[model samples]
Target: MDIHGTIKIDELKKPYFVWFEENWIHDDVLHHHQKGQLVYVESGFQYITIEEKIYLLPQNHAVWIPPNAVHKTNSHSEKIKLMIMFADISTQESFYYEVNVFSVPPVLKEMIKYAEKWSKQMTVNHNENLFLKALFNELPQFVEHSLTLHISLPKDKRLAKVIQHLHNHYRNEIKMEDLSDTAHLSFRTLERIFKKETGLTLSKYQQMLRIIKSLEYLSSGNLTISETAYEVGYKSVQAYTRSFQSVMQFRPTDFIKTIQ
Candidate 1:
């Protein structure tokens, strides 16, 4: 089953890796890995497709893809990632729905390799784990990026409010009427704004919402395809898979496989 999906994590080492691009390895076809990944592209750019969204991560940037996400790594320049794999399974849920990036500081750039060595020894103790945990917490949240991506919706003020609410709550499935009442706009006006601002109808946006949520979930090994699909309001995995493929242009399983 390729359960481990790892190299150098055999008997002698704990689940951790400091892979220079040349040291990277892959697994058998059709297997998905559930492990925390911290990728740092020190020189060039790389596009990591997770759940079908292509994130062009450039130099000085790092991405954290939680376990089990269907993702792949390809470099426009040399890419080096210091990845940590945790089989304990608890770290999977710590950040389950979204991918985050942080700017690497000078110390972290050095610490990434140092920590991996310390972890392998099995002797540095919990204090080392604690330090990593705190550093993870201090990692940057791209507030500017978030604000830039979020633009104000169309002019129907009430309608705008409701649509904004729904968009932000993409993880949860919302009904049309609830949205209408919340915005104090007629369903017709809200529908128009949904189309105008997002380039998709309200119903379409809702579907996109579920897809995105599922995308994040599918990438984070914390949720299985079936579990996350249903949780995001799909009635059947087959239906979710079809729609997922239509939008993402990549098979979920295949996407996960190539990432190693």
Candidate 2:
């Protein structure tokens, strides 16, 4: 898919701040912008693909997408409430070029909410400018709370096909040998290439997909623990819990409690 584009910010004035609340269902084309972007998920989960790696942003968390970074997004839930903001590139010196996910502090969260309300009611003014300045100033401190759970993709076309297949069939029982056949490579070669390109074995990559997907299922609050386990292809709840804890550093129950 030729899903690539750029977002121009020449129309936006300096010290610019914009907020949007969206419920995205379809996947967006990969694109980049000259201005930095901040995305905060207030309710549901979002899957962001950046540099061939997919990062899952669950509720109550935010991601900073620096200027000129190619990225795409897929919403995993209905009514996925997101607060998207754009800032001028010259406003901050410590802005990162890489995507980073961090916990949203209550103070910053309220600031964003207030900005959203204010933006809807009026245009940017002196008071709003001060809010934007303070928001940008406090953003750098939250970078230390970055969380990483990235599933890397390979550049090789054959391996890329295999990875896509696994992503589509993650909830099903998939064998490495079968994947090798799909990629038209020997099982050993498939294993080697997968590790070399993605720094993860095929099994581990599959596990990461499952765990990340489970976050969406659990966040919905409609599935029981056992149901979620089975939904993610885990035959047993214990196995699912182990994988969840290993990837998320917390049990599924505890995670649900926090998000709730």
Candidate 3:
């Protein structure tokens, strides 16, 4: 998927820089940089893989990549618009040390949009740099809006088989003993390895995967809320809504409004 052979910018040496990319299409190879990156999807979506986990960045959301974090990304939508900011963070707070995906608040969204006008390396005392500093300082407060949308793939070969099976049958009922048999491990051993590798229990991981897949289904506009709930394996709309709210921190109707 080399729609663009390479989109290059000298971001590593610059203290701060901004790049506005429209309809970006690249399946980037695994790479890392010394600068922290903030990629906001103005429209469409992008998928980022970090530490064997896949994170979906939908419209009106952003993903923060800490300096030196190993990852790769790809976006399929021709309508995609991205505002990417790179900053040197040697003296920054500890908050910038982690990877996160969160909904872009209205204020931060506007700030990022406004930042599109300046597309080159910024000097320390430049007016744009001051605004960028302010944006970074206020980001910790917004981290509370982080979403639980990442899907983890275990490194263990046997556990990975179970994860693949879960993804293929997420819309149907699953049994633990069945997964254990498929993994060729005892039930307790299978669960233990899975939890250790993914940091989530099997049930919790399944619930999260269902909710993440439902986002794509809901955004496609062919399914109503109740239909989407049932499509993702929920027995009732109320149960689905509860799970959605727990993971996304918003109701399904509210999310629909943002995309529409």
Candidate 4:
């Protein structure tokens, strides 16, 4: 069924939790629900596209999706385990109005594990009810740790074509003049509009794409760090490591160790 149809018919009238451990290879169609959604990735990584923005949710991180905000998810992994919790709109009305991705606190992670088990038993007690309420209350604290992983796409068709070209050839040295020609706009106009619409310079956006693609390559465990670096257009491993650490706040080796 289409996502919109499923959500419209299966509206959550009360707080609930649903856990999924599956191999997601295809993308979900854009959809929205009336209840707020807090999705946590326990393993693997997922790309969530909301409106014109796409956010990467890595392992041990989570994203809060405001109620009725259109979004979709995609992943290139075989072990994507996720926990999705739903709260009535009335209860979380003031929680968030847009997607907010952040690191999951250890305490909150444990609570989510318990909530997953509790949800299956369909048992509700005073203590469990209170626990759920507390979990909901603790969500706002994560807003501060939100990551800048989101990349907003341009809406203009001409600009979008240029962006698409960058996505296709991110591993090569793309010249600004070439991009301007592709978009059929002057260099100055293209630069200004690209920054204004996406809130990132064209160069920065290309780097962001390369970094995100590197994550997928690294997760596959088939390539060495140097190979991954070269595949993502880094001429040297040192340069790639620096860029990765600058954006992710950790070395690639550290991430590999954690996942291993």
Candidate achieving the largest lDDT? 3
When 2 and 3 are scored with lDDT, the better candidate is: 3
Per-residue lDDT of 1-260 in model 4, one digit per residue for the tens? Answer: 22424233134334654534454343478777776788887777888888869888777778998878888885436678777776655653465676788778778888888887555333345666677778877788746656667788888777978888988999999886778888889999999999989988888888888888887677667789999999999999999999988877888897676444
Global lDDT of each model? Answer: 0.53, 0.77, 0.79, 0.75
Off by over 4 Å in 1: 1-157, 164-173
- Candidate 1 overall lDDT versus native: 0.53
Q: Model 1: what TM-score? A: 0.41
RMSD versus native structure for model 2: 3.4
* Tens digit of per-residue lDDT, candidate 1, span 75-103: 34333333442332354344533565544
The TM-score between candidate 2 and the true structure equals 0.86
Query: What's each prediction's TM-score?
Result: 0.41, 0.86, 0.87, 0.84
Candidate 3 stretches greater than 4 Å from native: 1-12, 74-78, 120-125, 220-222, 257-260
Off by over 4 Å in 2: 1-8, 22-27, 90-95, 120-124
**Compared with the true structure, what per-residue lDDT tens digits does model 3 show for residues 67-146?**
77878885445578888887778665777988889878888898898888776544444787788878876778877767
- Candidate 2 C-alpha lDDT tens digits along 96-180: 5667887687778888888886443234577777887778777888666566557887888889789889899999998778888
Candidate with better TM-score, 2 vs 3:
3
Displacement of the residue 227 alpha carbon in candidate 1, Å: 1.6
